[model samples]
Target: MRAVLLTMAALAALGLTGAVAVVALGLYNVSAVAGHLPGVSWVLHTTFRNSVWLRAPSEEEVPELDDAELIALGAGHYATACVPCHGAPGQEASATMQAMVPEPPQIEEAVAHWEANELFWIVENGIKMTGMPGWPAEGRDDEVWAVVAYLVSVQGEVAPELELQTGGSEPEEYCASCHGEVGGQVPRLDLLSAEYLEAQLQAYRSGKRPSGIMAQAVTSVPEERLSELATHFAETADEAGDAPVASAELVVKGEALAREGTRDVPTCLACHGEREDGRRKGPVLDGQRRGFLEVQLTLWRDGVYAYDPLMHAAARDLSNEDIEALAAYFARR
Candidate 1:
């Protein structure tokens, strides 16, 4: 009886091994043209869902809901970073995106499966089998989070200001009309802060940021003009909050968190503004909105906001509580 049982078990093992080898050796068609078999598709989908869930980190901390200014900042970043690939509320992905394999998933359906951390990680590291490329500033987690905050705002009744900035002109001449002209439709020199403008220019110059049209536009400008252009935009004194307002309570709570982080996290001002000799290398976060703030914090925590190394480090340090509080506090401004 024991021998018979052993023999049966051995036969079962051999059968399974042979089946595995057959699949591994490409005995089955694995082409998109063929599509997955019903059972295979189910298995793959289920596995993906479960994997995302299992790998995602959970936190008891909830994001603060009152950040209106931060959300606005996020909008600008989003308009710059994500819109080209994911599209906005009324916009669609670029024609090139449609041709990508496995295509960029619509943000509406895609953001749900990811935790804040997972999102950040994916943005920073990028997905291996997908079209998603890691942010150009591979280490810039702060920017990644900011963009995530913007993504959340894009979902709602976004204000018109969040609209893309445009200049009606021939491709090469378009940016010039606004970027260089005095009293141009856009703000002129001395309107923008040096750091803010410089970063954008560098992103373009280094190919860290993508923009076929803008890339061409910047190439002709002298290095000094590029710096001049950034100063022009940053000095414009644009008040951050253009998005919808959030709650006062949320903003207050967010402020508290930003000013004084919890055990595992550092308060933002420790490096951001309050520091006598400002340790933070990234942008200042005063007068941002809650909606924009929340999305960015979520992204930073998730590891997606990529632009600069300092930004990445700042974001990587954020706990969910800090993210919520920082966003809310900034939003109230």
Candidate 2:
């Protein structure tokens, strides 16, 4: 027993000595230019792969990725946040970025190795020791998924140019690509309050709200033009036949929920409905797209928006059915 203890002590002392010597004598190479040795590189790569595989959410947790609108939203964000580090189809990363040690891989080739869940994990929580940054909006997994959705769609194909139109101040042309020339898949911006529109834009810019698409979109608009863009969209009327057709039962349920509110949930009209004082705390929900409303309500319930505690509280108890009903009710208006 004594011999075994002595041998263990000797090994521990030897290990400590080597560590101390390396630090005291500066034996380790700390320079980025020196780069990782082949063995070290393999270890890191292996560790990263295993870590992502273990930590990634299950496939069931991931939302549908095949939607064209969702993919476009992801593309819009990728064009700004990712294109500089990892080039898109037809676009090459800059020389400086390419010079990075263990350079960012072209996502097209990289996506083939990872599943949708793994991609979401990486985008939401970036890899360490790599130049990757996690999504800026902390709880906005929806936005992260959008990026993942786009990546999945464009994996083998040449990425289309999603650059925001700059030069002029008009938002209509810039927004038309995704939101549609007359508001199709996306929510009708015209029905939204200018205040609500501007607030959301500012939130995206400040990273208070997590949206790679919105963050990039707001950055393209100069500070002076923000209000103008908001007002432009806010005043425009929704085009005829733009409203989605919801089932009568769903619409009835939604109307009741919006007007009456559940025992635990407050009436949507309490804040969104017209007030005698002309005071409003929430954005006008009427005429907004069902999908957009459902997405926003889900985010609120998930505590993504810290700016609005009331929304978080109101949406906290809402179920999927409740959200669908409310969305249907508002879309009909």
Estimate TM-scores for all models.
0.46, 0.84
lDDT of 2 by residue, 285-314 (tens): 777787778888888888776677767888
lDDT of 1 by residue, 1-333 (tens): 999999999999999998998888977775655655768656755775666556544533224322543344445545545666676665666777676655676665566555655565555556555656666554444445555554555444453244453544332233433343312012233433587667766776776654332343466466666666665555554432244455777677766666765565555776556355644544566655443355556655565545555445657766776676666576454
lDDT agreement of model 1 with the native: 0.54
Give the clash count for each candidate: 50, 0
* CA RMSD, predictions in order: 9.7, 3.5
Which of the numbered candidates is closest to the native, going by highest TM-score? 2
Best by lDDT: 2
